[model samples]
Target: MQTYARRLALVLAFTLLPLSGCKRTHQIIHHATSSEPDYTPQILADITPGHIDGMKYPDFTDIQAQVNNLYDMRDVDALWVKGGKPTAQADAMLQEFSNAMQRGLRPEDYDASRWDERVANLKSPEGAALFDVALTVNAIRYLNDLHEGRTNPAHFTFGVKGYNEKKIDAVTILNTQIIDASDVTAAVDAAEPQSLQYKALKKGLKQYLDLVPQDHSDPLPEMNPNAKSIAITAGYPALQSLQQKLTLLGDYSGDANATASSADLTEALKHFQHRHGLNEDGKLGSATIDALNTPLTARVTQIVDTMERWRWLNDDYQNAAIIVNLPEFELRAFEGTGNDHHEVFRMNVVDGKSDDDTHHTPVIADQMKYLVFRPYWNVPPSIARKEIIPHMQKQPGYLGAKNYETVDLKGNVVSPNIAAIDKGTQMVRQKAGTSNSLGLVKFMFPNPFNVYLHDTNEKALFTRTRRDYSHGCVRLQDPPKMANWLLRDNSKWDEDSIADAMNDGQDNKTVLLPKPIPVVVFYGTAWSDDGEMHFFRDMYGYDDDLEKTLNGGRPYPQKPMKAVTEKDA
Candidate 1:
């Protein structure tokens, strides 16, 4: 028994000697080639906790916790290396990082240019360990940026609510998605948005990036501000320049040297007008020239801004939604997912005016619960105080002429008097009829803004290219079509029935939908449709605000939350 104990002691001493001091290198080398490699202690000793925090990584401060989790997953061992060399996964992810700009991300943001040098330094064990930590940190940052965007939407006062900003488990993603995948690029690509709109925007981003270099050397000359509208005519000095610019934009396919606006050029100009949200007059006008003269860089910024806004959107609602793009003055209802998805309906819409702060339409997302046929327009308090009461004071018969009535807090009928309004004892409401401000019907979502989709008495407003004439609510050009689409799945309501309900002339008849549909009041100034980028005027300076935020400027003032009230139908 004594002899056996002595032999056991000798074996233990020999085994621990290599790990103790000067012989540590032999142990490290042995473990590097062993089946169960365990160089975690050495790697952890080399990479201090403050190493990444001190590095110049974009958004590193924000994602420090994720970076810590990545190291913990591997028990503090090196990730991007094997046998003191950079792994194939590291090479592939570096390649992906280089092409980050294709997704509207800056390659410099990930320090992609320094990767080759870092990989070359991996000849030493300490260098390999440091490169491993840095790569892991960058990988996590890239995933976060690709998934939830680099900027926090809440910081911009974008009214983002009910969204949890999906937190990813970096360790699991690294192990299951990237490192063990057959195709590293495919895995990285899978992390991006799955919506068709996002894919289209990404394709558009690449297209516009390619156009930047081509158009930089030859910019469109600015048009004379006092120049009158030019039509298809011979002997025009600017005709050749116009042809050259229009042809570059794919709106013209005629000879660039043509001195006259031939039939082909006229058709092309009309196409350009249609693409640019202009009146298709087939003539060169100030507005058309301004759009043409907008710098290519500005167009690139528009695409990037739109892409950033796309990242703010919640991915859950892409399956089915009614999206009202305020700048475009358009409403689109999509049904299904992926290739199966198709636009079920589209119609012109009149959003709130942006000339004043009181009337600018807000960007929000909510679910439509029901529809109110023959709806009344419950005047908001702000409108009542500023517009209605003053008008009533001036014209005693104003309420009667406008089909408006006074209602007490209990919804009981009351006489219209400026005194009761001033005392806050009564409110004014327009009744349902052909002349009613809410036209015949209103779609309700019950948001804090008191905004909803409704038919309007002023249908001619939709014909305007820039339709921003509503009082914060959206005015649908074709309410009947919207009603039909909203009630498609509800057996209780059909097209004829919906029309009958709308014209029933009753006061605010509400029909509850069997299934609520999601509605997103989105604001995107630029988007791609049918392989062409469509740009709209920045109605509310949102693009400017976003650009300032992205450029590290002063954050926009957070909007004060208004108490939800029952108003504006």
Candidate 2:
């Protein structure tokens, strides 16, 4: 009877053992897949504490801190895996990586080519964890590049200032921006700049990239520099090629039967010239021919470079600001917010000449605090020593005839002395008048370069396509309009009152603004507006410098100015 009881006890213990095992297995599964708050132990157990340290990936070393912190927050769980397979979010992010070139980035720079292999390596749990970390690292890098730019602005010698780098935490981006989002693509797209100008440039970049493959194989014939032009005439060999090129650029809408220098061809050439920052004369001059021969691939590169520059611009300009694009010779004042924000005013501007790089405008961002009506042109020391002093010596009474006055170092009125001027102890100033270099009104932003926006005595310069005539200051075509817009907030200032202040014969009258307006003097060679891409001349060779820098060449340091020789003086 005792032996029979022992057998029954053994059977009961064995039966209950399987039931207990099943209960523990169910709990583990629940913990792994649960939506509860305290379900991290199983996930945490999957990642060993020293696994990240043991990894041999060098590409991810730069982002090691972010990756380490991200894993620690989740107790070292695999972020891109669930149920032993890659999650849908991981796949979506990989796809976005594959399309990085759409944002002016090289996909290979982000290891996009290795994505398929990385995804396939997810079969093993260890492989899954490492792949997850890599995806997170690359995603963070991609977002950063899209937000700020691949190259730092300081790499170029543009005197760029006020660039605020966007700081983002990898874990936060994963949890908030990606994890619960229904549309992963849209979530990722939010990383790019929000400016409408950037979007337009991005669209333009895509279009130009598509055109690169269709570039013409025919080499365009060179033009004779002394020849007047190649115009409407029969039997011109280059005409058909020109027509074909214009057609490829969408500038020529005429059919294949259209001949060169025909009315249709002339109009198309004019359009092309307009787009390329040339005079639209419809004649094939050397400049026009050279521009026409610029390969589509080169234009694609220009579009890419422009897009890169757009990334460096400030994301916010304090709700209202003025932007002067030096290459385009235009100033735009923008206001409002988001979709409502746009250019309230746009006008032609004359920027500094790039003559031997002496008068090239310095790119900077600052605030305009006041307007000086009938302001004096305080001659720069270099200009005074080099240009004015010699002229005064050669032509007696030249300063008085030009409305210029002599000023001691203390700014007190003094008699013009040739020896004092030659010694550089005294300065010169042009009194406010119609002939004053600063014209009627001057806008002051107070930069180190001593550059400002003002009316020009030489208004005819604005009519030229390339107006780089100033000595580092911007010349406004319509100073009255700018003053009226700037002082609109002050009830005392209206259009009529502003005009009176400008023309009231009150010399050097200064009026402080109610609020300071931000001013950004920038250089961009290409931009898009109204669904059309516009290209401009790299007036200062800045584009060439930037291109070399972007292509891994060292940026050339600016040369120091040569001392003025006796002859020059």
Error of 1 at 319 (Å): 4.2
Q: Write the per-residue lDDT of candidate 1 for residues 1-569, one digit (tens) a residue.
A: 75565556456646677566534444444444444345566456544453443235523445556666666655455777877666788878888789888887777767777877777777766567667777877788778667766665555444544545555566678977776566888877777767777788888778778876766324344557688777766665566666777777778876655543477778888898887788788877778878877776787778777777666666665444788889899998898877777787788999887887667777767789998899888887678887898898789799999899999999998988787887777988888888988899999887767889999999898888889888778999999988888788888788888878888746798888878878888787776778887888888888887777656621223334343333353
Q: How many collisions per candidate? A: 0, 0
lDDT of each: 0.74, 0.73
Q: Tell me model 1's lDDT, rounded to 2 decimals.
A: 0.74
Off by over 4 Å in 1: 1-61, 124-126, 216-227, 232-234, 254-261, 416-425, 553-569
- Indicate which candidate wins on lDDT: 1
Which lDDT tens digits does candidate 2 get at residues 1-569? 75565556455545666676754444444433443222234333333342333222234545656666676655455667776566788878877877777787767756777867767777765567567766766677777767666666555534344655444455677767785566887766777777777788889888888887887647667878788877744566767787888887889986766554578888898898888888888888888888888877777777777777766666554233788889889999888777787889899999887774768886667789999998988887778887898898899999999998989999998999878877878888999878988989999877666778999889898899888888888999999999989998899989888778777758999999998888878776887868888888778887786677656521222332232211100
Q: TM-score each candidate.
A: 0.86, 0.81
For model 2, where is the 10-residue window of minimal lDDT?
560-569
* Model 2 TM-score (2 dp): 0.81
Give the distance in Å from residue 354's predicted Cα in candidate 1 to where it truly belongs.
1.6
